[model samples]
Target: MRGEFAHLGDLPEKQVCHECIGEKYLSGQIEVEGIPATCDYCAEIETPCLSIVEIAGRVQTAIEQHYSMTPDGPDDYQSAWLRDKESDYNWEREGEPVQGVVAELLCAADCIAADILELLSDRFDCRRPGDPDEGETEFAHTSFYELKAHSHRDWDRKWQRLEVALKNEVRFFNQEVLDVLKSVFNNLHQMQFRTLDVAVVQVGPSTALEALYRAREFQSSLDLKKALESPVGELGPPPGKYARAGRMNASGISVFYGSEQAHSALSEIRPVVGSNVVVAKFSIIRPLHLLDLRALKTISFKGSLFDPSYAEEKQRIGFLSTLTDRLTVPVMPGEQEREYLTTQAVADYLAGMSEPELDGILFPSVQDGKGVNVVLFHKAALVEPLAKTGRKVVSASIEDIDYEFDVRHPEYEINTETIEELGGSVPMLPLFFDFDAHLESLRQPEHREPSLRLELESIEVHDIKAVVLQTTVLPVRVTPQRQHRAGHTESGEPKF
Candidate 1:
């Protein structure tokens, strides 16, 4: 009610305050209610906006294109979220349909994205524009809603009993999403659904950033490119898109009320949440990409980093190269495959390297003058949380929760590496690329390698003594005290 207001004609057309507009929007200065604050562009588009109902209809169509239920169908790899038929499920919203649309589109895939804002409900409320009847204007508080799924595993046993595994270990992926949701949850104490558990699989921003690079490389590969260009029967989705399930870039999550109910409901569904066609794609494709060292060596950024417009991809590729060059990573041994270091292999190796090992490489600090040494890549993981039987099963459906941050402070960039080099490992954990074992390794005394360990048992001799020989070399663990710089942890405590 007390904020600035002007008619469309009064505002200058050529003079633009785009930055000012963004600041106002982020700071909650713009709202539906109070005095009518008219801008030239907003007023022009206001009358032409489509109604919310029409927008929902478009969303329905897009959803149909993206998610298919038939086991053998094109979207079979797509995670089952909204039920098979449109009538089976209902769209739930409150406060404002515009807010709902905004929330939904935050993670929605390509098709319905362009027309999102036009669908805002006419009834959508913004605080009254001008001075209110009350003493002051009421600003709308931005709220964040997070969906999390956890799985329980029996670490002592190698997943023998589903019951035991469900009881002991909670598994979840989509590390990038959780990190953001948790950070927001921490900062915005007023957020709804505060009672939900906050169990984050500990991964430093750096490791997560490296993993994202690999995800991007996976997405950019020639094989994936060819798959998108040519119609492939095995993969789903419209042309020029890979199957969503194996999508290194996105994921889906389904929150269930209970185990019996979840199973009963999901049984009608084809595969378990994690074992779907999408997961299978990653299983089949990731290793092959890893072994295909040529793919790794051939990775190149599509644009130039020095130019601000094209800086994103270039910055990422440059950082990846800098990190790869810094680390003394060993060749990743391939099974019936060559053991060598390609650019991508180096990325994979560095991704699995523990914080201490990374520190060793980056210690004595070399500065490339890159904006940030670490960057982030996020996948949409599907999360399914069941309530009925309440088995501690952890299910993740990766969804595209587009949240990101940079460790811009020089101190964080300097300290972690410097500390590790001085015979100390930072607390940062190694991000295990193996999805199943990712969270588990975080809870370990030392992070595991990209490959599993193999042991040789001794051969028995009938009458003579026999000896056991060590055939293969195992990975070493990096250990030291955990250090934090400003902007790194939830506490926002800088321990430089």
Candidate 2:
């Protein structure tokens, strides 16, 4: 009844997905063991739910087309309904579901997103197309739609950018340009369309939302059409009272996601409207079996680990110093210190760092220390640890190298103390050696027996939003040596 599926008739007033139930289990909110990989019960229910989503998409499309074709439909009362399920888009391919579990859920959630948009339109006095130069007559709401695959990482990055732009009150259009455009639009269109009505609607993990928020000069629909029709590259900024008010009219964003992590991240960003954008699932609207099945599949995949506190005084100073040097911010003449360090500026700069830069800040390189210098030789590279101290990470290294003691050989002697001018002990270690062999030895239970150790570390995407890890050098018998090609050694042999 709600979305065109008869099975959706038994919709519960409130329902939670299997993954959420699983999350409860993982978080100790519900204590249960032996959780299965795929919940057969939930899958069966969700399959039918996908049909409702497809139907909703068709219905929404139909409505939009009707409006576009007949701009003036004041007397027209049009509604859409799915005739049959068999003719609807197939939710299965090769006997398997065409979409992922989350995707299927999102597919249904799209209908809910549309409904929310509709509600918003009525509240905002959404102005449909009237005058030629005014605004969109077909669609009353000023919103951009972004559809994408489900990627929590991408969503997090977008939220970070949006937060930065919003907090700084970044201005997109020149006031004069906006005024002229607004006047032109007002005279052309019979209706008034304000920028404040516009909003960024994100369906999945979208890159377009970032562009919309970050663009300094945005052209209206008419401006865009004119630019395409003409040869001029400069169309200028969008015109509206909201356009000149510093921040773009899009004071809010509506994000849709199937995962709990995505919802949690979106909830953190406060918007002028619809910040907590959880989608209504058609699966829940299905029969009573659907509710039971929903209870079966929801599993929590959230993992945890110790993260470094970035707000510590030491870190703050280091971050500011590094940011200044890296970005090349200008200092007042004759003044070695920075004159201004606004919170917004710092946040914006921090947000601009690429993944690698952000990673460096969170888990910086480590210096030589007392504990086992655990040089994680992952895959085929010597993975560097954090430079600063006081953090620990328990991730399973790709490979572990061992330095076995051979008492019969002088190089195995632990008592040998060869001091260097740098005030460090130069132990009797191999000058030139095979990294693979060394790593294998470390893995070996005995000096001669080498093997690979598979250790799964608990690392989750949500848990590591920004983590500063502690480190101690893992003790391996092999001395650090430069990587070499096959059959190459400069030293004859190592001595104790």
- Candidate 1 wrongly placed segments (more than 4 Å): 1-19, 22-88, 93-337, 343-496
- Estimate the lDDT of model 2: 0.25
Candidate 2's residue-wise lDDT over 1-496, tens digit each? Answer: 3433333243211222333332222223112222333322244232212222332343344334221222321222221223344454322112111122222323334334344344323333444568345533333444322222222343234334543453455534334333322322121111111322111112112322111010111123333223222211111122221222111012111111111222322222222231112111111111110001111112121111111221232222222223322222333434322222222233223222332121001111111111110000111111111111122222221212344753331111011122343534444867888676565446423421111111112111121223233567888797755435444444634333
Cα-lDDT of candidate 1: 0.24
Question: How many pairs collide in each candidate, listed in order?
Answer: 49, 28
Task: Give the distance in Å from residue 125's predicted Cα in candidate 1 to where it truly belongs.
Answer: 23
lDDT of 1 by residue, 219-324 (tens): 2224333322221211212112222221011222110110111122122222322232111111111110111111222234432111233333333333322323
Query: Model 1, residue 126: displacement in angstroms?
Result: 27
The TM-score values for the models, in the order shown, are 0.16, 0.16
**Alpha-carbon deviation at 281 in model 2, angstroms:** 63
The local lDDT score (0 to 100) that residue 87 gets in candidate 1 is 47
Candidate 2: worst-modelled 10 consecutive residues by lDDT: 284-293
